[model samples]
Target: MRLRPHHLLCTQGYSGKGYSEAFVKNMDAVVHRLRTEDKTPIELVFSTDDLCSCCPDMLDTDLCRENEKVKLFDRKTAEYFGLEEKTYIYQKLASYIRRHITPDMLADICHGCSWYPASACREKITGIK
Candidate 1:
């Protein structure tokens, strides 16, 4: 599964809400697959990814309307996690993130995301060991 870096957090924080019904449905499926298939290989990309494929904001040119903002989020996430554009085992990556992430780090990486403020990501990430 291909995903943008910030999507690592987005997937964890997903709560059945989205820009549109199609986006929500797709997110549910993606999140479900990631949860159920721990061995799934996730390829981190800096560009629009599987989740973005269904996003309403994605234009026909495949760029998001809010591309610059999301790109910054991706960069910050990658920097914070020392992540590279490579494949990782879903379970291992998720575990690594949960084990090392702190609320302060999350706040720094996801500061401007529209979803960050309302999502349970901070609570969920902090709750994990």
Candidate 2:
């Protein structure tokens, strides 16, 4: 899975009503698969990949309607983690997430997201009430 930087955060299990059912299903499957497999191949890239490929809002084949919004998520994650484009193990990435990302940071990054208010991801990552 070649994922954009922002997807590193979004794939932690957030779902919004605006997404297509197919997008939701594919994302769920991808996240589950990555979590269960110890060495699933994941590369950090600037362009879209597995997750955005299924998005209903995709335009011109690969661009997302929410591309700017997604970019913010990516930027914040990269800034906090000192990320670079590289191949990584999914399990290792998950560990980095648990170790490096903080609740306040996730909250600020996701605040502008349309799904922010109802996101299970927000609750899980931040325990925010």
Candidate 3:
């Protein structure tokens, strides 16, 4: 599965909501697969990925409407997690995130995301209210 760096965080925080029904359905399937198949190989990229394939914001050119903001999120996530554009086992990556990511770090990494405010991502990832 191809995913953007920040999408690792998104998958963890997913709560059956998205821009559209299609997007939600797709996200649910992807998240389920990752959860059920811990050894699933995920190739992290900086560009549009599997999750973005069905996103409403995705353009025909394969860029998102919020491309710049998305890029910033990706950069921050990669930097904070010491991640690289490479294949990783979903379980290992998820474990690393769960072990190391803090609420303050999540806030910094996801600062401009529109879904951050409304989503329970912080609580889900950091176990903090």
- By lDDT, who's the top model here? 3
**Candidate numbers, best TM-score first, in rank order:** 3, 1, 2
- The Cα error of candidate 1 at residue 17, in Å, is 0.8
Candidate 3, residues 27-88, lDDT tens digits: the string is: 99999998888599999888999999999999955489988898899999999889998999
| TM-score of each predicted structure versus truth | 0.93, 0.85, 0.95
Better of 2 and 3 by TM-score: 3
Given candidate 1, what's the lDDT at residue 43? 94
94: Cα error in model 1, Å: 1.0
Give the alpha-carbon lDDT of every model.
Answer: 0.86, 0.74, 0.90
Worst 10 residues of 3 by lDDT: 60-69
lDDT of 2 by residue, 1-129 (tens): 788777777776555443888997888788778767878878998667888888877774446787787777777777877888899776787677766667788887776886766667765554555
**CA RMSD (A), model 1:** 1.9
TM-score of 3: 0.95
Q: Candidate 1 on 1-129: residue-level lDDT in tens?
A: 899988998888787889999999999999999888859898988899999999889984438898888888899889888999899987788889889888888888888888777888888776732
Each candidate structure's count of clashing pairs = 0, 0, 0
Score residue 57 of candidate 3 by CA lDDT: 93
